[model samples]
Target: MSRIVILAEGSFQFHAAKTAVGVIRYSKDTVVAVIDSTKAGQDVAQALQTNFGIGIPIVRDIREALPYQPDTLLIGIAPRGGNLPAAWRWQLLTAIEAGMNIVSGLHFFLSDDEELRQAAEKHGVMLYDVRRPPEKKVVANYTPHRAGSHTILAVGSDCSTGKMTTMLELEQTARQRGLNSAFVATGQTGIMISGNGLPIDHIICDFLAGMVEEMVLDFCEKYDWVFVEGQGALNHPGYSPVTLGLLHGTLPDAMIFCHIAGATTIDGYQHCPLPSLPEMIRMNEDAVNWLHPHHNSKVVGISLLTHHLSEAEAHAEIQRIEQETGLPTVDVLRFGADPLVDAIQRYFNA
Candidate 1:
């Protein structure tokens, strides 16, 4: 595994710093340090406001992190447009010149950029643009759906509201109970962690569902349960299509609706307040049923991201969602995923 320094720069928050957040939660590799001048000298736990067990330092720049001897500098902020920020160019070049490989989740391919690519080559370092879609020759065509294949997708109220986190915990808890489980990654961070899965958001809109269907079908044979990591949100105007496509493609037997505890609106769209929990639930079930009328899929549980709340507040919110939606609800990270896993087993294990 690589020793990585995450470059979140000025944008390390719950909203824009999902890549960094994902790594802190679930990287197989060692995150030696993080770079964000704004929060320099703070430990990652303090900076992110959540303890991820390891004490990762936040340094001012690449030069400060050189002593850690990191092999890779990971671009750890997934900004609105997925473009490399102008402010990051020099930091990127400096890391490449120091012979550290670059792994970026940005849609802006660092490997395709002439100056950055040449610098990497000169230093004998590699560049991995994780969000770059595979060549057409390798992208999968839609496959026939299998019967009795249990899949549960983690759809969300907004982007970066713990969809991947929920799916991952569900998989972990399922295996702890001795069930065969598989996780299908749908984004670059998930791909980085799982070492498998296509970056579905990078695929063209036309092939999105087909690619997702192919991914689900591939995993159906080996695992008793397949947990598809979802992207974006159904209520997000910018990303609803991707959410809809994934919903149809996975055709999950169950769904976990993910949401942040106090988020009233889409992160970037404050004017567009989130749908009521019941309304969101209705929309998801309607979308799934519309996609596959004969298949009766339902929202099995709610995976609320409660990292921002107090334990008492988290529990209170959990109870509220359960009562409101009449479904099991949990903060899968703060609380174990047992409740949601029990819901899944109850619904699908029969």
Candidate 2:
């Protein structure tokens, strides 16, 4: 059995740690332990109950938790303002000295922080700064109707967020509009689609050469519109660039980009080592410039995944993105009945 210890101190780290546990729950080889210094000597049992409603004990220090001999120590602690804390730096060193492989979602762990990053690398540890692949349980019995045209509203953030629920709601919205829409689980996990209650197969695995073209062509022949949901995090393994490439090749009539706006979005840009959002917009412009020569499809608009944001905050974020990128942005939640329905109608018309 492989033991994995998650070191969490702050609220955000605690949530992220729990999410990681959820992602790896199916693995029989993994055992997870949560460590928090503030809660030391207290009943790990009781603390877990209060914090996460779990039975895992919250040990006070890493040394006390070391008896379990975890093979992997996942550091859920992040540096304030994107800088690793001095104490956490020492704790990571201690973990390595204790012979545990370390993994972290901390930006510094993933960044070019030479001192700490190099130290961890020297210990032969794997530092994974990437988001965990979404854990979607497949409903094997779910078989979608073989329709001629179907619209799939796959919702997920470019980062970890409420993509699943957004996708589900989009499906509901489609159904309300009298469109035969389905929620497709292109992510690694399977989700139950509304209406038909069928399981949206993960196209990453199920799709073969020409399979996408065949599916799209068939759906167009049978259904009025097909709404395919995109996955969260463009870099996630479950997020197949190839799938997006295929969609582009097949020439979808319209494309909608969903952006999840939360307090995290403000700092997300700092954590992302890739091109900034502005750069991405520029790249999109360049790509559009080249692709539009042969293809003809409009980038319908950007939708905000506002699961927890207030109306004002959501609107502000949308406005910011619109102002920055010169692309129309809509708050998916605020669009409500009239605007969402109208957008759907207009999308189909385009």
Which candidate leads in lDDT? 1
Per-residue alpha-carbon lDDT of candidate 2 for residues 26-128, written as tens digits (9 for 90 to 100) = 2344545666777655443465433333555556667777887788776554444445667666766777777777665443434356765676677777655
Candidate 2 deviant stretches above 4 angstroms: 1-157, 161-164, 188-190, 194-209, 232-246, 262-295, 325-328, 333-341, 347-350
- Per candidate, the number of residue pairs that clash is 0, 18
Worst lDDT run of 10 residues, candidate 2, spans 191-200
lDDT of 2 at 285: 35
lDDT of 1 by residue, 1-350 (tens): 99999999888776678788887778789999999999998898888777672588999999999999999999988776788888889989999888899998898999999999889889999999898887762333535466767889998899878899899989988888888898899999898888888888878877788778877988998787899999898889899998988987787778999998888999878899998998998889899888666658899899998877889999998898889999999998888999999998898756
Q: Alpha-carbon error at 63 in model 2, in Å?
A: 33
TM-scores, each model vs. reference = 0.93, 0.45
- The lDDT of model 2 is 0.49
